[model samples]
Target: MELRTLGYFVAVADAGSVSAAAAVVHVTQPAISRQLRQLETELGLELFTRGPGRLSLTAAGQQFLPHARDVLHRADEARAAARTYAAGRLERLTIAAPTTTLTDVIAPFLATLTDDDPMPTVFESDPREAYPALRHGADLAIVTEAPRSTLAARALASLPVWAYVRDDHPWHGRDAVALHELVDETVLALTPSFRPRQILDTALARLGVPLDRVVDCSNPQVAQALAAAGRGVAVVTDDARFGLWPVQIVGRDGPLRIDLFAAWEPEHHAAETLAALAARLGEFCVERYGPDVAPAGHVGQMGREY
Candidate 1:
């Protein structure tokens, strides 16, 4: 099928109706509708079901959605690669990653860059949005999960998730606190959007530990601030702040951890160079954080939650 037809199909699916898709695609409603019909006929599958003023994907269409998106992404990658080829070399790169990663990890890494390295830009997004960020525009995605088999993904580091408390707090000088131990304490936590919070919630549910008093904040720094004020114990992956001591969060089997991964399209014109860049970044993380720091203050764990 034509790439244009696939584009129209995707547009319709995203916009939820033919007319809306037509507006997005800058085409007449009848033209786009005709294109969809022809696309379905060519594939021998009904892609969508009509409703009052909406269209929903059929079962087959649901299964095909990722494949369609992959094709479109590959096309975009090809165009980008071709442009890079025409330019003889890559000039810049964009990295997509979570806010803490950008702030604590990447910012320092950027300072170590040489004058010869491609100029880099950062996009703030969660690990779950890594691949989508790449499909949209980013050259690399730093995520908590290893990417799909199709893309090149390199494990960077598994960083520590700590329960931070001020010097005067009871747990401040302690080696570490068991996840179940948080049950009795007033706990400060980040929202579910962060991997540490997600890991904490899962471990709490699995361990049957219900925290009596929990304060959820959207920002890790804010969580730390609240903990420093004696409000609660802040559990986050960020570095120590507000003169607070960091304690490794011990889960049932091990410590709570956020695994970092760097991903990129393997077929890009500068794929090899990107792999080298990923390698450099991974090396830097290992050098800075060590392989598995899960033992005490800055430790790591084998079993990952995020």
Candidate 2:
């Protein structure tokens, strides 16, 4: 089927009704409905179940949804690639990143770009989804851990994890606390999808230290807020600006750390620009978090030929 038909199908799937889809696609309701009918006929499948107020996807439609989206994404990428090549230079850069990196790393790095430089677009997503968006078309993705992909990556920083407590709390003023020491404490944690939460969960599981209560948060700021309100012990990276007392999470060797990376497709036309951005990001992290947190030998390490 035509790519426009796939776009119509995806809009209907997202909107759940023809009238809504028409509004989104900037077409008349009858036009969208006719297109949907033709698409179903061409595929020889009933893609949707008609109803008075809303529409729902059929089993066949559910199976087809992801592929339709992929087709639309690739089509858009092809158009962008062609335009970039015709222009003989990159015109814009799209970077996907987790929220933490957006706040701590990317925002500052973006300020350093010259006005004539290609304007950067930032898409905030979960760390797990960021790299996929990059692979799909985003020029770069900054994530907390190494992604399981063939994309070229440059390590940026490695931040030590800490347990934050209110000044009035009993754990305040402590230099460090072993994993077992937190067994009976209610812990404020980032959501399980985040790399830090995964590491904390695995370490606690291995140490046989069952957390009394786990308060899940979306970002470090929220976790720190909860800790300051005496809700629970917030597990976070070292941030002196938050004003919370931080206790190092001592592991068998030493403090727990999480490495962050800037990743991009190796063959991207803007590889040199991406490498420059990665180096700038590394420097920004070092300036904000200190040299200890900056990954060793990360400078000038991007865009290595794969």
Candidate 3:
């Protein structure tokens, strides 16, 4: 029931063993084991499976893990808030972004911060989790799609999605490839949860193109690597450093593209700071992608046409 016990439980769950959890928490094995037993007794649910040399979560433990993590995260946020208030400085911004955006957008945006400004805390999170993290405590969230909430948001960048191929592949030297042209070829795509993947799927579905033999990758780097190995054509955002031939996806109208947004609550105490950071991020995207990608407007307003 205690916060300390929850922390101990999370450590045990993460480490997968009592002794390992004790090592991480700097507690003796017996103490950790006793605390875990007490926690299970209070909850009236078995959290872990016991074996001679193995420890694993039971169904109940697996179900409880996320809740425990949320509690710990909120506790940490409370402590941070108190400390920042005591120090009489603005609360340090915490920005959460998906892995791809963390590399392409957030990192570059952060490089512009000065010493007088509180250095923002950056964390890599799944795009689906970004908005929720913001609602919970994060100051800023970088997401691919517009958040479902009414949070204030703005388009940060729009990157053209490219089909990458091995140097010797037939499509390597092409300027563009139609979506249907890829229908007959094996495609390496980002995972379903990714915005690019959602866009690609929708486009293909609308065109009645069957995506029967696609390889799903969790990250762009993996997809690019598989394409380099000639496993298939990798679909990703155009990053010249990837060292692959970038072929545009030509639709009937034009090329396919994906937009990234920075979302934040307007009522948050850090609203002004968040807006400033968002503007800087927009500028960073414009510098990298070109002036055409300027932040259009606020999310529900007259901003980016897409």
Candidate 4:
């Protein structure tokens, strides 16, 4: 069967209807239906059940779905690899990390790749978007939390957390403040789509701090700027705080800490390069931020509620 046929089938399975799949694939419903029919015919199995309403995958389709997804994913990866190779780009390293981590951890580690021959083009993405890329074929990902039952990654390191503000902020002048006091302070926070928000929520629940005045923002640079302008305290990694602002750590307990990890597809072909990057990244972390630093912060398991 054609790779495109596999892709079409996977799209239909995910969307649960030809029209929906058509919309996703930017093709007409009949075209999608025809492709699915062709794929089923070639495979000698009924992949779906036709009904008055939306489509449902048959038992055969259910069995075929993962395999089809794997094939389609590999095909897409091959296309990306070929294009990159043709353009003299041997590797495409996609890092899914918190903005702070990108600045503090991976970005510094990337100095090695930059100085090397045929340097890889590094793509930065938020942790939330990173997992799907890994499933679809990202070279490597750094995340605060891994998905449940995901056996594709290795736990790397855990890093300390810090509450930072603009250098001119009141909190910055103070050497430290009670953790409870942060609840009353105006804070800059990342969007909920990002992992930091989940981490913040989890921490607040554990410490029972009321986060009432959050200024919602998307990027860490923006958040740090807001905090730098003396808006409020911004929570970030210790390394991230030092990298972003000239702010001092002002929490009485010092700062909250979290675990970070590196994950990749176990069956990926570029495992050697990916592993090399991971090792170099870890060594860079130790040199710059200390060996105790996590590649990303862990936040979910502090309390029973999380």
Best-performing candidate as measured by TM-score = 1
Worst 10 residues of 3 by lDDT: 297-306
**1-306: candidate 3 lDDT, tens digit per residue:** 899999999998899888898889999988988998999999999999999855789999999999999999999999998886566456578889888788877787778778877768989988878877986778888888866556777778778888998888888788898989988778999988888888888888878888888999988898998888879989888474456898989766567888888888766766666676677788789988898666465434422223
lDDT-sorted candidate list, best first: 1, 3, 2, 4
Separately for all candidates shown, the number of backbone clashes (residues 3 or more apart, or on different chains) is 4, 0, 2, 10
lDDT (C-alpha) at residue 113 in model 2: 84
Best by lDDT: 1
Question: What's the TM-score of every candidate structure?
Answer: 0.67, 0.66, 0.66, 0.57
Candidate 4 lDDT over residue span 207-235, tens digit each: 76677798888776677767767677676
> Tens-digit lDDT track for model 1 on 1-306?
999999999999999999899889899999998999999999999999989989999999988888999999999999987887676456788999899989888888988889888899998997778889988889889887656777876677888889999999888798788988898888899888778888899888889888888888999999999988989899999988899999998888688888887788866667666777877887788777876732222211221112
lDDT of 4 at 60: 94
C-alpha lDDT of residue 217 in model 2: 92
For candidate 2, write residues 144-246 as lDDT tens digits. 7765457777888888788898888888898888988777788989988788888888787777777878889987898998888888889976364357898
Q: lDDT value for candidate 1?
A: 0.84
Q: Rank by TM-score, descending?
A: 1, 3, 2, 4
Name the 10 consecutive residues with the lowest summed lDDT in model 4. 297-306
Q: Each candidate: what lDDT? A: 0.84, 0.81, 0.81, 0.66
Model 4 residue 48 CA deviation (Å) reads 52
RMSD, one per candidate, in order: 15.2, 13.4, 14.2, 15.5
lDDT of 3: 0.81
